[model samples]
Target: MSDNVSDGVSSFADLGLGPELLNALSGLGYEEPTPIQREAIPPLLEGRDLIGQAATGTGKTAAFALPLLQGLSSDEGRTGPAALILVPTRELAVQVSQAFHRYGRGLGVRVVPIYGGQPIGWQMKALERGVDVVVATPGRALDHIGRGTLRPQEIKAVVLDEADEMLDMGFAEDIEEILRETPDDRRTVLFSATLPPRIKGLTGRYLRDPVQIQIGREEAPPGEAPLVRQNAYVVARAHKPAALGRLLDVEAPTAAIVFCRTREEVDQLTETLNGRGYRAEALHGGMSQDQRDRVMGRLRGGTAELLIATDVAARGLDVEQLTHVVNYNVPSAPESYVHRIGRVGRAGREGVAITLAEPREHRMLKTIERVTKQRITVEKVPTVADLRARRLELTRAALQESLMEDDLSRFLAVVEPLTEEFDVMEVALAAVKMAYESSGAAADEEEIPQIAPKAADREGRDRRGAGARRDRRGGTPAQGMTRLFIGLGRSAAVRPQDLVGAIAGESKLSGRDIGAIEIADRFSLVEVPESAAEQVIKALRRTTIKGRKPTIRRERDTTGRRPR
Candidate 1:
């Protein structure tokens, strides 16, 4: 059973949720509690602290969020924060805030995300106007404390999300300082993937008689579908998008999610995928709830087969027959890699988890492998020939199934006439080929322009040891293409330096040759000589800086305007 499934699932109503929220969860398409939620919510609603060992996309936000929202509603007189959620990055902060906003829409609640890289004045104003909940990254929350624009004295509940991550990023002191600033009586919830000494130490110092929820491997399964095959492909970053496209061509999932690290990447990859002929959607923090819903609806109904999203945006998503989960970029943390892969390989069904790592990222990949204790086998992205072979296999399987189940007597007359003009075996082969190629060429294929890999790890092996060899052996020179406006923008809080550094370090270019830099709070525009655009893009797959590996392409005209 997938850990996502609640044990014998309980009704949300039975969980003792108020009517408004019960209706909201149902309307939002949530049917039951995930394991963490079932165990965590009741105590949290009663105002107890919690320490959750959960991963992203496991529905842990709602486990804490529901009770937090409920407690706030029960105390309508409190103008100050009733709950505070601490996340690791600006992307997560926004995503958590949005979840609260959606669930509390009827409560007239205010949930604001406070993070750095955005104007502090805006956050200061939001805090002053008053908020019931504040979802903030630690550094910015600490910044607010130093600036004296926020008060934690009235805070009743404080939840630490991805706690292990905050500590790993060296925020233990800051987290401690923030916790100390809050009222001593406040309910403290600490959620971490692993209870390292740091987490245990912090929990001892902070939480008082809290509930401990551990999600183990023998974890219960939920009401999840059963046909998806789960496997992970380890490839270098530069080839991720192309690798993903190749995988799509190979598996041809009716619906799948290719998880990226940012909204900008979501948009950029969505465009790349659409150009490749798949109906793709982009889901991320910048999109409104209505937009998110519509995207989900399309995916569930099969109107869109590919969904490109950041890990934050794609949370709590459940789509039927979701055949693949491609990590267009490897996650920054090991836990994130688990969560991304966990999305696919649910229930006893098979699923695929594909990670595009750069050469330098081999260490991170190894780290993820060590933590999960799961091998992510390195494999070449399927060349066109492999795709053809896989397609032919599918074609053969379909034909065999049809022969076993469907009556073919009616088609014998047609076959008899065709055999009159050609050898009977040749006629049968031709008919089969025509039927199979309807899905496009699945046999006897040629080489494709191989995307380059970021070869940082193979220091002494054959120059063709990994990403480099893949690039040298496969890719043709790309020309006549100017850098394109990739949808991954500043709204996800991306920066020019992050982009430049990523492109330079990942690709053939030294940091000096990359051109102009433009950044918006939502998006960014970078300039590179038109000739090397594709290779530069290929190189960026290996550059995993800023914890976000996004797509780089030619800029669109609408985004060319600079923010004054």
Candidate 2:
């Protein structure tokens, strides 16, 4: 067997990929293989058991996908899927399945993604008909095995993607169960970001003398820093929304994922950002599989620029053009922070990781910095003047690009006639005004107040209490009463009674405790006693109104205005 590593394999062709796969890769603009792909593809193509250690966005998907697709039998009457890839989350399952379909399109490969929250009837029918590859989450895949719809005996290869995450998510038993069902002689491949003891044990028990490959973390030379520029802004909890808006205006990332703590926070922040004129989408556990798919479609299609998500919902998501990762709040763990920032600074591209920290979370930031061994510059929030300057800068840059690249000859004809009636400078000023307005520059918003960190002892109790409350409420805690932002509004044909009836029917709170309900064009806001907010959100998420479940979250407004 050839033991050539990534250095000798410069392209997919060098890795022994077939012409059909190479053409697909070329069409997708993949000029060369990533390090993991370069190293893992050759051995995998030889049908060798392997263990790969690499983080997300390292092109790990293609490393396994290409080899698996190439190994598929071209026979038209295959009875069962030849390969099974088990992933940790439904999003990853779908993404991996799509990759297989893309790479194997010319080969007429049949791929299916099976996960919970999707109807089982279609999956059953698909499996019964025939498939070449099945990408699935462990839980859903186990369910199919029990139902006898997913025949693992015919599987020729098995892959566990993101094995560490699957173990952390408590899927160890499910993974083992599925593995036991597969044939003993099947090739096994495991990929993980970190190989803890459990993962090592898993590999020892399942893989037979696997080829080990690790793509280590990229370290900067001597004084240089990593590509992802890390920064943090200290702001009070109440001013976070406005501060995020101002900061986004200044940074203006092409696409970003804003990580929130919970489902309610995801929904509320999505609405708040949308109200601020951003195209934002919410992703959380509460959303159905179809809703999640639609949200991802909008993001990938560039119809949405901001994605507000909870950690659980954002797992295993890989967006190629993701330029920024904004932590709306400090992550609970150092590893979580690492994972969040890892989404950016990928593929040798310059990216940014921004964190908006409450004054009390300053120490947590310190912990993250120390653990990651990277300096996080704490910067001041942009002021009104700064925002105005940034907007003007954007306008000037737009005009400059247009002047350089656009064919303005026809527009110059109109400018010539105008110059006959007006001063040249005056005509230019009129054109600039139209260009600025058309670029979507709005009036500057009020500056958010900066927060000063307190001593550790004094801040600890308050921080703990706030965290507890946020956990219960699914977002920032309400002061006296809680206000919830629901994704459905007049657009969904919703009424105040609909909100009232849903809450009253689902939760313990009475209509009297529920305050004013205001339904807007696309969303609604409702207020309830602070103590009952969490219970209300949980209940309403499970119970639907108008035969649909609207995203519900604690209101994030700091303006303290009661919704009419």
List the candidates' TM-scores in order. 0.55, 0.69
- lDDT string for model 2 (1-564, tens) is 225577767788998888999999999989998878888998998889999988777889998999988888443556898899999998789889988888988998999999988889999999998888999999999999999999999898999998988987899999998889999999999998777789999999999999999885555444333557787888999999989998887766667999999888888999999988899999998988789889999998878889999887899888876878999999988777877888886765546799999988989998987876776767678887776665564455445434534598987778888899999999889888887676556555577876644454335434432212211212222456667777776557675557877998899875445554544445666767778888998998898888887667665435644232
Native-referenced Cα lDDT, model 2: 0.79
Tens digit per residue, CA lDDT, model 1, 1-564:
123334555788777789889878978988877777887788888787778886544578888899888878778677677778898866578778888988888788899998766789999999999888999988898898788776788888889998876876678898999999999999999876667677888999999987788763323123221222233455555556666777777554546788887778788889988887789999888977568778888887767878899876765465645757887777887767665666664432345566666656656777886787654556556777667665565465345434534699998988988878899989879878897788666432444454343353232233322222111111221232243343345356454445655776677774445543434333344556567877776676666546766544444333644222
Backbone clash numbers for all candidates listed: 30, 0
C-alpha lDDT of all candidate models, in order: 0.68, 0.79
